[model samples]
Target: MTNGARDENVTLEALCRGDVRTCARLLTRIERGEEAVIPLLQALYRAGGNGRVIGVTGPPGAGKSSLISCLIGAWRRRGLRVAVLAIDPSSPFTGGAVLGDRLRMVEHGCDDGVFIRSMASRGQLGGLARAAGDALTVLEAMPWDVILVETVGVGQNETDIMRHAAVVVLLQTPLGGDEVQAVKAGIIEIGDVYVVNKSDHPAADRTCRQLREMIARGSRLRPDRDWQPPVIKTQAHLGVGVAELVDAIDGCFAHQNADPEAARRYMSDRARHRIGEILRDRLDRRLRSGDEGWLEGSIEPVVSREKDPYTVVAEMLSRL
Candidate 1:
């Protein structure tokens, strides 16, 4: 093997053996979408499927960072190594994270058992970075017990996290109107655990009541009569109700472990989604490399009504 390939294999081995620096470097390479990242990820993918991945998502101002901070503490107290991937909004000019969640979680910087990385959403509408799944694979190779993913706080389109995480925590506050509408729209269906954060507010009880009712109504529509999500109230900043939230998450994990079919289905879905993402990325790269000119030429005819977009796309695919 070549020197570079040998070096990569060494680094991959170190990463799997719990080398923190190597793990961080591999994650950074994945986030940058480096060409060499694919081989590294493939080598490490099978070593994963052991870590518990938890996704936390909510609208803006839901205090997700604080909640995650509390979770880290709780998990650490139980002697489990944890990794966090916090997806933040990208800066339009630089395509970097605008506000890194690491700042909120500074207290854990010195903790040896914790590893945290912040990723930019990079304009992905799903509230996750494009490389998030790949990053998770890398983290899973390391000796982590749990991996927490905190999304960019986009109100809608955050359901993409469901494809990667086994357990999803959807946070909502007592903001009343728009918040309730958001829950009704679709986010309520994806959660394994519903949390009414900032529960110290006067409307906390009402928010919990509304969420329970919606979950009850939604459960009836689901074909599978399993796993009724429990809504718990929490004042995250004050560290209240966090233990119960952890227990609920742990219970959900236990339930999934007890059902082998459900576990297999979740893993199968994640694999399918990962394959689709890889195919799409490859196609995009191929199109950018040599097909841009042809695409531009084709666009004008469609714009002038000479052809429809579907036909043009078909012709392009046939050429491929």
Candidate 2:
């Protein structure tokens, strides 16, 4: 083995032995795009199917963190080791997260049964998705029995989590407006289970009903599925209805894997995504450095509006 491989093996061995420091280091390396981590991922992937990956997505302040905390409690009761990849949106200007999603789960930070890592969007929507996968890979190398991905409640681009997770739980609040917005965002189709959180709120039932109606509409349009997504109500903080939510999550995983086509779509999306990410990184580097002659030439005219962006892009590609 090369020196890097030897070092990686040591790291992997430490991970398997439940060394949090080694695991954290490996995760950092993976985040930095260090190839030395590949062997570690390969080893973990080879050991395959070590954990159940659950994705929790919804609108902001929908109590997703509380629900996740409840779920972690549930899993912990079963004596399962859990890992959470909680993604927060980076500021458009500063690139730092506005709120620390991981901080909300600080109650479980010392559990030893749980590992929670806070991640920023990093300006790549796809990066959040891939980082979740990488985090899962590293956690899988350890003794984790379940992995949870908590995405920033921003609906757009967050669907990328569906590719990596075995089950997706869509959370929402009592606002009729948010339910309509969720439908418009196409989150309805991607959800395996729809959770109407904050059930103690007065509008919870109405929001639940609205989601059901939306599902009914989708059901009529897409009649091919044997199973339909179910809406469950919960007050996660009080732990009311958490059992049913867990059952729904289990059922969704069971149903999702039973369909080969669903698995195929996920695999295809993941494979294509990896390639696309590499190209995007390369292109971004090229553009930032002004290394490509075409981009260098097109910059001034496009900025000056002497040439439109569309024409400039076309000419640049043609030149390349």
Candidate 3:
């Protein structure tokens, strides 16, 4: 079938029943700024609160993927339909990653109960909050019980991941100096659960203790009666601590039940992010259509210090 016809069928199925492929196609259409997806996304928002989204994030090479694989296995054993959204880093040259997750998640490919979508970062720095929110709408509407969002490990972006996940698992290791800096970027402060991945390493105990100290400090700062974020050490490659991690996540879900405010914030953020995505797309389309020379013309002025980015944006908005 023609791509247009296929997408139309996709839209129909996605709206009527939980169709993963159709949802994927609609996501692509939305990503490409096709106007057809606007109503579909709106419908998804109207049918919100379908699934619990768990975000797994950490520094690069923290065994996050392995941990997620273990978690998926554990969740699947419970007969839960799982959807995994693994966001891989894009190469600066080819705009793709060397390590694509599709190769690793082979078990899901054949299982109708499992859905896996691998996303390229696409040069979106802090916009993961938007991509994940869109992905969740697509997955939640489908026949999935749990949605997992795996992020390309970075600092500020980690905080952005929490905005999308109902339970945010912050993974780290036993490194001393720069490691602390990476965690202090604020991911550590927001984790619903702390995971010291590669726990077989010699410094696992040290890392666990450091994370506990940090959590204690955070508790003092917040003074909330909520359960303290538990730090679990895990040898993900060997599947050790996977069960405990799952239990910890369950605890997060339980805690969230008691504190409805967390769910309120999740919904509130999702709504705000949806609005931001629409506005951003609108602005981008306007800028692209306005003038190819607009940016070229601004360069000389910027080099001469005659105008700053703020001034340029104001001028552009004024023209719009």
Candidate 4:
């Protein structure tokens, strides 16, 4: 095995061969918030993207894990390698996650074609672990044909999936009009494919109808304006309709790639978002870096009303 610390090309080569041990170790280091992975990530970025990043997000008990497991099976049957990152809610005190999502995927444990890893959300907002993009950078460099990212089952505005994935699948269970109304507009705007899971439920069709109506009227803010988001129903646990779900996903990806204009626009938007994310994360670390004298110098004036916050912000921005 090549030493990733010394040779990023060698590491990239190993990763391209789907070196599971190396990938796992790198992800572990990244999840611990290590700074050492930066160069490797840079190399991977320059190496260019490989896998299709598919993001799955929905509310709690939406059977996202089960659906993902089934999707992995479907993709594997198509002779495609699959990787999954399941983001579990972390304990606030311990900064640890139970990783129960992994349990739901035990069926795929023996498959060499599939790799499943659970990441702690670590109190990060936007339904993902703070290290998600870093983790994704690692996976996207690997040999996987598809990389599946499952969120921590958060609410509407937290649809950070759009920033990372080329395709986003939003899941929902059967619901009445009122319950469907609770699915906020922000989430509605983010999904490239909407799914009504648990299709066996009595109100499933009604829920799908409501979703279509909402999707039809919401003025979808998607860059692929010529594309129409499809709504599919799946009984995931029974493995029913999963093939259709996969078909929809395949169709969505094809549609997004079909138009040269949409493809460029989407890529540009995603790059812009990634830049903003990196800037914010870097600035946040700098601010919270705990230089007592520098902090006291910055805060004292504001405390004494000698400096307005906006002016102080300008000063800090200039310094940073």
CA RMSD of each candidate after superposition: 1.8, 3.3, 3.3, 2.8
**Deviating ranges (above 4 Å) for candidate 3:** 1-12, 127-130, 176-183
The global Cα lDDT (0 to 1) of model 2 is: 0.76
Runs of candidate 2 exceeding 4 Å displacement:
34-49, 126-130, 176-185, 260-265, 282-297, 305-320
lDDT at position 278, candidate 3? 66
Q: Score each candidate by Cα lDDT.
A: 0.85, 0.76, 0.76, 0.85
Off by over 4 Å in 1: 92-96, 176-183
lDDT tens per residue, model 2, 69-163:
99998889989888888888777787666657776776798898888887777666642634556777777667888888888775555577766
Model 3 score (lDDT): 0.76
Ordering by TM-score:
1, 4, 3, 2
The weakest ten consecutive residues by lDDT in model 4 span 175-184
Question: Compared with the true structure, what per-residue lDDT tens digits does model 3 show for residues 104-204?
Answer: 66655688777787777777775252356666776776667898888887664447776677788988887734446534645667788999888888888
**Candidate 2 residue-wise lDDT at 150:** 86
lDDT of 4 by residue, 155-242 (tens): 6678788889989999989862464574566776778898999899999988888888777776454433866778899998899989
After best superposition, candidate 4 residue 73: deviation in angstroms? 0.5
